[model samples]
Target: MMHEHIEALRQRFLHSGDDADLPIVDAHHHFWDLERNYHPWLRDVPRIPFRYGDYEAICHDFLPDDYFARAGNHRIVKTVMMEGEWDPRDPTGEARWATALHQRTGLPSAMAAQIWLDRDDVTDVLAAYRDLPLVRSVRHKPATVPRAAHRRDFSAPGSMRSEGWRRGYALLEASGLMFELQAPWWHFEEAAELARDFPRTRIVVNHTGLPADRSDEALAAWRRALDALARHPNVWLKISGIGEQGAAWSVARNGPVVRDAIACFGTARCLFASNFPVDSLVVTLDDLFTGFKTIVAGCTREERLALFYDNACALYRI
Candidate 1:
């Protein structure tokens, strides 16, 4: 039934002649080999607490073929690979693997490599990433983010407020790379501070600040944080991962979040991404994208093109 519904939705978008053939540069996604690499979250005995609940279904190797198969009707010309949590011992290992994967697959035109900002070897890791041609940015999810409470606390060892993390973050400009920040809305003010301190480096917030709570008050708080962060011209937003726990993805639930994000960041500073494999736990590729297209169906063709294609290319240099 869900597949039938998705097909119907896909047909609606395909029939919308204005932007049906719009080329897409999937701003974010992932490919992993559980056999070759040690992803602690996926391979560990106890699964780490995930936003999408139990994700055992995706525990196997997810290579390029898997991604291509799930891409469905969307004409995904290019993609930006987000770093999966690979072995932390050798931080540059993921980038090397992705570079090799791209050589064979010719997908993931760019990559956001993993780098622990607070690690002692961060300087060397950043240097290694700079040498990898596919690496366009790096991700280091800050420590000590408040989950249940919306309170601000940046004193944790690897939090964005930490001196060591800031030192590593400051080097991104010199390395010619940007940053991928994955934190909840409550942390955006701290992120805004990080953005202010290092004005030269670009920071792209992951998962729309993880707006998981869709309550009226929660959304208002998310919007306030977005407003604060958007004030910093260096910050950008990705409209993906809006799925709710234990619920199917639909336009009715996610459309407002998408539209609000674009309104906050504007089309130029906003990009559309699948956050695939991770988001696939809640939504299929076709249905997820169909929701994106349908929600913005009333917008101008140029605006739609910017969200779906142009912005990603420019932001990631894909």
Candidate 2:
């Protein structure tokens, strides 16, 4: 009987055109007006080619209108805007800007601002973010990818295990902000340790442990990381950014990764996201969500609801 239900849902999910009727709370995505905000990576594109070369297509001002236009075919009820790397000197500037956009446009239902946790004024920064009604979480994306992987390591030597970073992480629960962590699989054990030590703190692991290498050895490491982190009830996974893993954007290619991740974390722990603009470098918004819907076709409608909206609402408190 359960197998019959699963197959029925799969049939509906596959045949459904656009799936535009379903409500979506985009757990991750970004909104940036490049002219007003400063993104170092976006600005420095010419000199340093990002991992996926020749990204001239997405080099533009992507605002709320642009996002909704891109999302015309889907019922995106809400979005949690991940902090764009606004100028680092005034760390809270990005959140403030995003808050104002939320007030004016009503697009971003909530926000996750970026903070340099190791800095001295971190508490003051977190406090200001807390003042904004829309701010629900914080992200401090340090480089966990080893230089041996031929990627730049911007994080301090210890990554999540660094003393100062831990000190700052301790403050999030009290401040009403969850931590949004973006790191490679190598740092998952450290992330698991962080989750255990600060069980009070809610952490959302970004980009599905960023299985960027995708070799059999790399996939094994990524799975180990996901498995370890899923042990903590407080730790949740935002399943997006598979596009950056060097695979072509297609349901056929991405299905295995998505299916395995959901199996690992379960529907209750998984949050669906577009990772737009950043992910737009690889595929269009429509293609991304459509592919995602197809990949999870076997899930029951209730499970699909949790994946698309309910889980995001609970995790980010949206």
Candidate 3:
């Protein structure tokens, strides 16, 4: 009975035709080979049973061709590849793999490489990866860390404010590469500070600050942080990452939140991203994009175009 109920809900979201018109550029998507890699989190998280094998079972390996065939119905002209935590044992291997993927697929117009900001020699690391033709940004992914890894006062300024990270960011800025901010929602202020300090760097805020679950305080704090960050002209926000939070959230639940983000960031600085496969765990690709389109339905065609495609093209130099 419980399994049937879950199926019914999934079908409802899947069948919903909300993305008929938008010209999308999926700014966030991932691909991984579980066999060749080790995902520590996936090993323990029983809830997400979809391994690379499962992806193959469901859709034949979640490759670019599969993604284009399934999610490209809305006309995804370009996509930006976000790094899946690659074999951390070899650190630099992910970028090399992504570059190989770029050569093979030719869909990821830009690549957001994963890097460890805590590394002592981050400048050298940045220099090494920055030369890749498709490498447009770097993501440290502070958000994906375990909740226990964070402190109540994450803003108290220590490692985050360190010279090493800032210097590495400076190298990124100098290279004219964008910085994809992927920290938890609460770290918006810290992200904002980085934006302010590195005026020349383009900072793209992934997932509208990744608002915590439907708590009033979380929502309120997310709004306030977005407001503060919006003041910085260099900071842009992506309307992505919603579906992964849970399966219970729907267009009905998330539309207003996305609308509020558009209002705060303005269509020019905001781009729609389908944070794919990760999002697929919660909602179908079509449904996810459909929900986003529905949220921005009230906008004029020109404004909608910017959110759907133009903004991402410019941001990633696609």
Candidate 4:
């Protein structure tokens, strides 16, 4: 029954439209070593049978080859690797791992390594990882925890006000590294404020700030926040992660949401990203990029190029 449901969802996205053979540069993705890391959330989720070994075992090694195969002929020439849930045992180990992967894959033109700002030694940590050839940005991931059960209820008042966190963010800005914001919808205002405050820092908002479920109020809030963020020319929005927010995974369902984001962020400030392994929880790589193509159908060739390839190259300095 579960397999049947998954198949139906896949077909819904697959049949949405023909794949437009545009060259793509996926801005965000992840690779993991089950043996070396612990994904506590995966184990706690009852619906998924995934374990540390299950990802590699079932996918035959979740490496660049696997990503390229799934991306097919889309010319995914570059990718920016994000930190998966780093092993708590080795907080800085994820950066080391990404460095190794960059050497091996020769694909992730750059990486946005994860750092915990809550830690006292975050400055030292960022300094250490900044030396890696592919390290271009740092992700504090403040939105990893949300206050609301659904994204609609989220607000970032208290979270962004942390003195230590703000100081760490200053450190990231001073180091000339981009800050990747992965917060829920409510945090968009705070994110915009951060962007405005740190004018020199390039802020990349992941998952279109991850809007709440579709509704007039939700759309209005998302638009308001997005518009505010756009006032800061340095802020960029990544159109990824909409599928996972749906009731059930389907690219067709995610299309409008992503389109709304693109419309708000515009082509230059907007970029396409495959949230990969995380997005794999919702749709396959082909379906994900196919959905992206559908959302950007109204764009001109130049606009499409910027969204899919050019923006990423410029953002990550690939």
| Residue lDDT tens for model 4, 34-105 | 555554443334435421223332332357877777875565766888877665556678778777877786
In candidate 4, which residue ranges exceed 4 Å CA deviation?
Answer: 1-21, 39-61, 143-158, 245-252
Model 1 clashing residue pairs (backbone): none
Q: Which candidate is the best by TM-score?
A: 1
Stretches of model 1 off by over 4 angstroms after superposition: 1-17, 147-150
> What overall lDDT goes with each candidate model?
0.85, 0.80, 0.71, 0.71
TM-scores, all candidates, are 0.93, 0.89, 0.81, 0.82
lDDT of 1: 0.85
lDDT of 2 at 90: 86
Query: Can you give the lDDT of residue 287 in candidate 1?
Result: 85
**Candidate number with the higher TM-score (1 or 3):** 1
The ten-residue window of minimal lDDT in model 2 covers 149-158
User: Which pairs in model 4 have colliding backbones?
Assistant: none
Q: Rank the candidates by lDDT, best first.
A: 1, 2, 4, 3
Looking at model 3, the pairs that clash are 56-61
Q: Per-residue lDDT for 109-137 in model 1, tens only?
A: 99999999878898899888768989999
